[model samples]
Target: MTDAPLPVRRALISVSDKTGIVPFATFLAGLGVELVSTGGTARALREAGLAVRDVAELSGFPEILDGRVKTLVPQVHGGLLARRDDPHHMAALSAHGIGPIDLLAVNLYPFEATVAEGRGFDDCVENIDIGGPALIRAAAKNHDFVAVLTAPAHLAEVRQALMQHGGTTLALRRRLAAEAYARTAAYDAAIARWFSSANEVAFPPRVAFAGSLVQTLRYGENPHQAAAFYRTDGRAGVATAEQVQGKELSYNNIADTDAAYECVSEFDAPAIVIVKHANPCGVAVAGTLAEAWDAALRCDPVSAFGGIVAANRALDEAAAEKIAAIFTEVVIAPDATAAARAVFARKKNLRLLLAGALPDPAQPGLAYRSVSGGFLAQTRDAGRVDAASLRVVTKRAPTEAELADLVFAFRVAKHVKSNAIVYAKNRATVGIGAGQMSRVDSARIAAWKSAEAAKAAGLAEPLAKGSVVASDAFFPFADGLISAAEAGATAVIQPGGSMRDAEVITAADERGLAMVFTSMRHFRH
Candidate 1:
């Protein structure tokens, strides 16, 4: 009812994570505030030579059921939830010998950490705090009269406010109450997700997801929108990479860097992938990262400029020197040598990220996207094909070299946007066309790109000559296949599940091209 600061007289402190708890309680006690705590916290405060009152003593009842029913009594909630501005609330407190609790500092059990550590089910269940969330919610619901702290980070701010205003102000109480509710909500979401997984429920009737804020970006995709980054999964990649040097990464940089890293991780050999606007401009595998870079950059030199580059192995000085020669925005790898770091230091504005390790390409995970009213969730695109999985659908079978490039091109096509077309020779991409409405248009665009790259390199012939072509989905008509054949593609690989599959195979055989069908379709959007 009023915007006045309330003086703290009685404060309760209980925390599973005891970081900075003793000093915080000591500060509160110095202000002549009574300190009431529970089991381990009370013992800790007493051992620190601070006088403390136990919750059992305040409620006049002993803790039972392994301390599960300690602070759930009416005494605790009545003190936290009662409205101090009401005459009836004061009368009820006076009639029951209840003292108003002005401040509550509590942190829930380490359920998230327990699950992350792969602990046993019983241990994880035991770590779930029962009384902590109840206290937080009650205190937050009565923010006009009560203040609650959910994390140790909140202690410093509250301590500062108390020192400045001589207590917690109404504004500070409202802010802390909002944060308290958010912390509890995220905690509950983690528990719900874990339960769904443990029960083998692939798609639960009700699902919850939570994330921790990693940073606040300067802008979103453009300068007009605001955005922030959050970490939801623990898989290693751009989200978890450590920046060694350069300016702060933008939203586009993070997205493009993630795409490049995921594309590179698909290869076991030393590899490099160059991505621009979240699509792979080039990708290659070789004996060394330096060689891979050269081959990958040769795919589309014009588009490789200012692109995000990802390497599957540790970066050496040779590779770093070559990458630094180009105007690259970001370079990500598992690790870097000292000489490589020195080479990158000259380009102060180029971001260098070391991810410690590459993410597993075949690991089972979930992918989510926001829709109009809700979100869409599905399993990650981890399907892969090998030489043995290929079915020869043409008169002539592909040569050994063509077979290897077919698999390589299909893998790169998996990371490209659909309708996708990729042309690869040896182990490197020569041309890539993505996100077109018509498959024929994508094939034609890829051929044009190959010709432009060849002209830029002063070569008489385009790199797509004798290369293998891969399609992300089944070809609805034979026109796309004809385009590849006309571009001098000697072999083709695609998912065979369209109504015009017979017609397409007839066209491939007539063109004297080797074609194979992979039952799996990789349609990335």
Candidate 2:
């Protein structure tokens, strides 16, 4: 059976944001409902010529301790929690000289905004609302009897419901109650995350996560799953990127674009990364953005179809022309030239995003994954190693050019899913193998991909010929080491930690392969 509307006898209003409080309270007053409020809300309502009863008067206790002890009094909660249908509860409320509160319009203090502004710790502590959350929980718990309104956006809807049903329907109360609880939960999460960050706690006693919904996508990784996009409180990446052109970004497009953008941020020079299915198919750095785009495309032209491209620098007309030739899904960069924008106009379906400068890979943050019953959180993978940190484990030291290529491959390996193998020549990835179960299989797949890519390009030799290889983790056996050597890889870089490390190093020595030990792994799952 459908729920009947509940009549409103009185409402308590308090809000940090006074966007539409007066008009709402006036409407409630017009319905012969008494208006009760505190602090700024009472002042605003009374200034608007509405007869408002102060909470200090209702509780018969003035707000004390800098206005912290106002609404915690029993008079406020007793009225909200009492069920009108229960004769004993009504008698108890009447005996205490307390009137029922049928509606609550309250919004919390701007705690997240205050923290975002770089305020001091004391300022943030003060902005944490005490009475607000208490009031919201009380009203939400008694949702069957009291209507709770948490946001200013809900004001119009509540007004419409009131006007149509002559009060708030049970359905409306339940919906608003759910929204209220979500608001308080997110608020608490933000506060918890802030404390964890401020205290430099890697694994807090309790993990807290929060985000605001930016958009509701058409679907998720597949066509059937529902999905939405949310931006974190402080960080700005692809989620905050501004779309200047094209159709709406799909779930895959957003995911792939983020992968492409993050990969490009690893390079100091002008670079471009092309991603397909959340994996990097092509990555290259060159003197100019146009050259980078061309070099990256040469890595895997067949797999570049409808791929997402991200450039570290601003996109120019020359790069735009090259990207427009292909049926690409999206182009993300700091900005686009006027001529480049004109070129993209022809491909209106292509998405163009301006994400400003690349995000700092060293920034500390959490990476979360949801399991069946709980979620997992870990620090982001921001490890970096350079030539100075390289330790040559084998007898042969890598030549300077091979060292550059080894570092390049290692950086690309960091973005690929493990077990990962990357073959790079110069500053461009020649071949990539990712997400294989065994490391040896990944090595074989990389060589095979290199051969296929060479054949498709109508080249005489494989792209990985004379290229350097980078393994995301240690080579568990000598077979993986021999596979890279067999594919014409002259040098290899890996985290040297395995039970058969000596055997692998001996194989590299026999093959005359130069190997460097980073002693650091980059595993993405």
Candidate 3:
């Protein structure tokens, strides 16, 4: 049986966001519904020439603690929590002169915004709405007899219900009740996150992650799995990006796009990173985005097909033209020129995203991963290596050109999967082998790919010839370094903490290759 609509004889509205309060209150008043509100809401209704009874007048108690304890009084809670079906509850409210509140409209203060604005601790603490949450919970618990409004966006539905049924349906009340509880949970989560950050607590006893639904994807990694994208209030990556054109982003598209964007952001100069299967297939830094795109694609043209491309700088017509020529899945950048956007508009199915800003590679943040029963949390890998930090292990030090390529290759390896091996020449990835079972196998695979790429480009020599090789971690054995030497790599860069470091250094010296140790490992597993 459809539950009968309950008449809204009285509504207690206290809103921090007064977007449609006046009009909504006016509508309620027109329906002969008594408008009882608190503080600024009552003042707003009165200013709009509507009758409103303040909570102070209804409770017969003055708002104390600078309005903090205004709605916390028993009269307000009793009216909200009372059950109309329960005689004892109705009798208690009547005995205390507390009329039942049929409707409640409330939105919490701007605590999240205040924290995002980098407000002081005191200011942020003051913005936490204690009374608002209590009132929302009370009304939500008694949702059987009450309708709750958590946002201004819900006003229209409530207004329509009042106009058609002269009250709210039980279904609408339950839905709004769910939304109210979710809003309070999200608000409290934001507060908890901010408090932990303020106190420098990396991992708290309890953690709550909140996200707003951005879009429901057609499918996940495959067609059988369901998926949706949710946005958190952190980072300027794919989550916060604006899609200018093309079809909606898929689950795999978003994942690869984020990987490409994060890899591209590692470089300061004009750079392009092409990612496939959430791994960087190719990466290059050049003087222009067009040049970077060409070099990056040259690394693994086969893999670059239908891959996600990311650029560190704004896209120009030249870069856009080059990227549009291929069957790319998605292209993301900080911005794009109008001419570039026009070029991309031709590709109807290609997704183009502008993130507005690039994420800071050095910024401190947390990374989370799920396991069987629990999740793992760790700080983001913001570690970087420079020329000054490099310790030459071989007798012959790397030349200035080799040093530049070494650093470049190591940065690329940081983004590559574990057992990663990257070969770089002139700040462009020549070959990359990632997520292999063995480091030696990764080196051989990278060398083989370099030769294949060279053949694809119709070059006589392999791209790894005279290039610098970088390993994400130390060489467990000398075989990996030997493989790089055989591939014609003249310099090597690795974390250099292996027990067989001496043997690896000996092998590099024997191959007449320069080797440097970063003393910092980057294992992206």
Task: State each model's CA lDDT, in order.
Answer: 0.94, 0.91, 0.94
Residue range 113-197, candidate 1, lDDT tens digits? 9998999999999988889999999999999988899988999998999899888899999999999998899899889888888
- Writing each residue's lDDT as its tens digit, candidate 3 over 358-411 gives 988898868889999999999999999999999999999999999999999999
Enumerate residue pairs that collide in model 1.
none
Off by over 4 Å in 3: none
Backbone Cα, N, C clashes tallied per candidate: 0, 0, 0
In model 3, how large is the Cα lDDT of residue 6?
92
Model 2, 1-525: lDDT tens digits are 237888888999999999988899888899999999999889999999999999999999999999878899889999888888889999999999999999999999999999989899999999999999999999999998999999999999989988998878898899999999989999999898888778887788877676778899999989999999988755656887899999999999998899988888999999999998888999999999889888788888888999999998889999999999999999998888899989998998999998877877887788889999998888889998899999999999999999998998999999998999999998899889999999999999989889888898888888899999999999999999899999889999999999999999999999999999999999999
What TM-score, to 2 decimals, does candidate 3 have?
0.97
What is residue 155's positional error in candidate 2, in angstroms?
Answer: 1.8
Question: Candidates' TM-scores?
Answer: 0.96, 0.90, 0.97
Kindly give the stretch of ten consecutive residues in candidate 3 with the minimal lDDT sum.
1-10
Off by over 4 Å in 2: 7-9, 22-34, 43-52, 198-200, 232-234, 243-245, 334-342
Reference-based lDDT, residue 124, model 3: 99
